[model samples]
Target: MEINPAITFQHDRKVMHAKRPKVLIVGAGLGGLTLGAILQKSDIPYEIFERASQVKPLGSCVALNATVAPLMRQLGIYDEFVAMTKVIPSIQIGNENREVEFAMTAYFEEATERFGAESRVISRPALYDLFLKQVPKERLHMSKKVLTTKQGGNGILIRCSDGTEYEGDILVGADGAHSAIRQNLYAELKSQNKLIPSDDAALPFNTISLVGQTRPLTTEEFPFLKKEECQFVRIVGNDKPFAWSTFTTKQQRICYSVVQFLDEESSKLHDSFRNSEWGPEAAGAMCDEVRHFPVISGGDKITTIGDLIDLTPKEYISKVMLEEKVFQTWYGGRTVLMGDACHKLSPAGGAGAGNALQDAVVLANYINALPLHPVVEEIEAAFEAYKTDRIEWCEKAYATSKMLQSVVDKGIKPMLVRFMMKNMPEFMKRRAAEQMYSSRPQVAFLPLDETPASVKPTHQRSLNLRAPVEEEVEAPAKTI
Candidate 1:
C-alpha cells in the first residue's frame, strides 16, 4: 500500500477532524506516550492526561530488544534511542560467594544477527525522554487525574480531579498496574455481571525490587564502564532472600536493582509497602537493608549495593512491587486498557517495558482503523481485535518473565530451573531468543519498515488493513 501523510490544512480543519476518532489517553507512561506519538505521526487527534504533576525518574533501566525497534524508527527516534543505549553482550549469573555459576553468552551474537537489532539497555529517564520528545507539549496535560469516566450516546467523557471534563471517541487506560480507568471499567462490568471472576481478583506477586541508577562514575572507580558492551552481572544471596544485579550503561553510569523473594511471613511484612504509592519514598527502608550486599562490577575493587544506592540521587531510587498477572478484561464500552494496566509483568525478564511499547503499536494501529464516527459496537470490535492480536504475545511474555523470575527465586524449584538454564544447549538458547524477537510489529498506517532480519516476524493483521482504497475494495478480505 502507498501511504500518504495525513493532511491537516489550516482552512480544512473540519475535514481533518472528521477523518479519525479523537483519542483520550490516560497516564503519560511508556504505553500512552508511544500511542500518542504514533497517533501524532498518523495525524490522529489525541490528548494525554497524566495524574503526576511532573515526570519522576522512578525506575532504573529498560532492556529494549528488536521487538519495538522498527516502531521506534517509524517514530523517527531510533537513532537517538540507539545513541543513548548500551548493547548487552551477555549476562553472567553468579552466586553469593561471587562465583560465576553460569554465563549466558552464546545467543547474544546470534540473536543480534537474526533480529537485525541488538538487545540494548537504557536508563528509565532516557527512555521516557526519548518518547516524550515526540509528543507536543500542548497535547500533554499533567496533573489531570481522571476522577471518573462516562460513556454517552455521543462519545465518552472523562472528568479530571481538577474538575475539568474532556470528551473523546475513545478512552485508553495507559496508567500503571493500579489503573484508575481499569478500576472504573471493572466496576461497571461487575455491576452488569460481565466481569470475569479472575479479573476481579487482586494482582498476585512474590517479589519486591529496589531499582536505581548511580550518578556517572569514573573508569578509575569501575573499570567495566569503559567497555563497548554492557557489563550485566546478577548475583544471588548466600542464605538471604535477596538477589542483586548491575548493568553498566552507555553514559558511564551503573543501573542496579535488588530483588527480594518473599514467603508468606515476609509477604505480610511488606504489606504496607505493596499498598503504598509508586515512587521513591517507599524504597527508603529497603535501601538500607540491601546496601551491604556485594556486586560483581568487574574489577579487584569490590562494591556493595549500598555504594551504588548512595551514589544515586534520592529521587531516582524506587521500590517497586513486581506484580505478575495477565488480566482477562482488557476493555468494555469505549474504555480500554494497555501496558501494565492490563498485563503486569515482573521486571526480572526485562520484557515489561518492551511489551508496553508494542502494545501501543498494535492498539494504535487498530484505533487508526476506526471509522470517523464509530458506534459503540464498532469501537468494541476494534478493541476486541486489538486484544486478540496482542493477548497471546502478552501471555508468552508473562510466561517468559515467570521463568526468569523462577531463576532468581528462593526455592528448590528455582534452583532446578537455574540448573537447567546453566546446562541448556547454545542452539536451544538461540532458538528461544528468536521466539522472543519474532513479534516485531510496525506502525500500520505509516510506511512499513524494510529492516531485514533472519527470523520471520509474526504476520500483523493490521498491516493488511492499511492498503490503498482501490486495492482494498478489490480484495475486501482485510476486515478486522
Candidate 2:
C-alpha cells in the first residue's frame, strides 16, 4: 500500500533559493476555489488556474453538511452560505414502480442538535460564485490549460497551452476526477519506474447518471419536493433499469439525479460515455431506457423519468458514469493533489464537494503553519501532513457514499436494505448519524494562531471531546 516512497524528489539542489512560498492551484472547482479563499484570508499569496474560458457556473447543485460550515464561517462567507441554502430534514424512498419502500425523518433535525451546524444543500453555481467573491479577479487566470511542469534551478515552472508559463513554490492539483495535473504527477512517477500499474487504473462505473434541475414543482404536482423545503428522496427498483434521488428545494427548481444501474443491456451503453456527445439526443436516448419507471412524489402523484427529462434543459442534463476511486499516491515533491484529484466518489451522500472543501481548508492550515518564507522542503512536509490528516476520512466517506449509491441501484438487495434501515430505532439512527456527522476535520495549528478566522468555533458541540489541555500533536496517521 506504500506508494512512491519510490518516487524521488528531483530538486535542483544547486539552484535552491529562499522566497515566500506561493501556491499555484490548478482547477477552479470547489477545492481550488475554497483553498484560494482560505489562503486569501490568511494573507497568503496564491494564483488559481482554470481551463474553462470564464467563471460562469457549469454544474448542478451541491450538498453542505456540518463538516464544512466552520470553514465557510472562517472564510467569512457563512451568512452568504446560509442565505442561499435550504435544509432537507428527511428522506423518502420508493421502488421504480412507485411503491413506498421506506422513509426516514428527523435525521437532519437530530444531526443539527448533534453537530451545532445545519445540514443544507445549495446550487453549485451559487457556491462557486460565493467562493469567487473573495478571490480577486487578478488572481484567477482562465483558459490556462496546464501542459506540464519542470523543476528548474530555482522553482517549478508550469507550462500552459497558450505558450505562457507560471512559476510557483508549490503546485496543488485540484483539477477534479479527470485531473490533468494528477495524470502529469503520476506520469512523472511512472517515468521513474516508481508508479505501480494500478496507479493509473481506470475508475470503475457501476451506475450511469443523468442529473439536472427542473422548473419549480407546484405543491399540487409534487408535495414531497416541498417537504421541509426539499424532501431528500431516493428511489430504487427490484427489477428495473434505474434508481434516483430528488435532491433539494421548493423555493427554487427541483434538482434531481436519476441513475441507471449497469446491466447486460445498459453495460453496452456505458462503455461509450467517454466518447459520446452529450445533448438532447443523448439524454432522450437515456430517458428512453427508463421512461417506464415511476417516480413517486406523494401518495397521490407519480411521474416518470420521461416527465422530468421533458422539463430539464437539454444543456443541463448530464449523462455521466458514477465512479468511486481512491488514488494510492497523492503527492510528489512540491506538487500534491487535492479533493477529487485524489479521491473521486459517487454522489451518494451528497458529500463529495463538502469533502473537497474540507481538503482545501486542511491543506491550507498545514501550509500556513510553516514559518515565514518556507522552503520547498517545508512545503513537501506540509503536503505529507495534509495527506496524513485527510486520507483515512476520505476513504471512509468514499465507502459510505458507495453504499448509499448501492441502495439506489436496481437490485433485490434494496428490499433487505429497506428492512434493515426501517427497523432501526430512531435513537440508534440518531447515534449512527451523530457518528457520521461529527467527523469535521480542523487545522491542528489554528487554535494557536492569533487571527480572527483561527478562533472560529467548529460548530461541533455534540462529540463532547474533552477540551485538550495543551496544543494538539500529530499521532500516527490512521490506516484505512
Determine which window of 10 residues in candidate 1 has minimal summed lDDT: 1-10
Best by lDDT: 1
Clashing pairs in 1: none
The residue-by-residue lDDT of candidate 2 on 24-130, one tens digit each, is 99999889988887787665679999988876433457878777876766666778788888887667777656766677664576554557577788776677788
Q: Which candidate leads the pack in TM-score?
A: 1
Q: Each candidate's lDDT (Cα)? A: 0.86, 0.71
Compared with the true structure, what per-residue lDDT tens digits does model 1 show for residues 308-398?
Answer: 9888999888888988999989999889999999999989889999999999998988887776566677789989999999999999999
lDDT of 2: 0.71
User: What is the clash tally of candidate 2?
Assistant: 0
For each candidate in turn, the TM-score is 0.93, 0.84
What candidate 1 gets wrong by more than 4 Å, as runs, is 1-19, 467-480
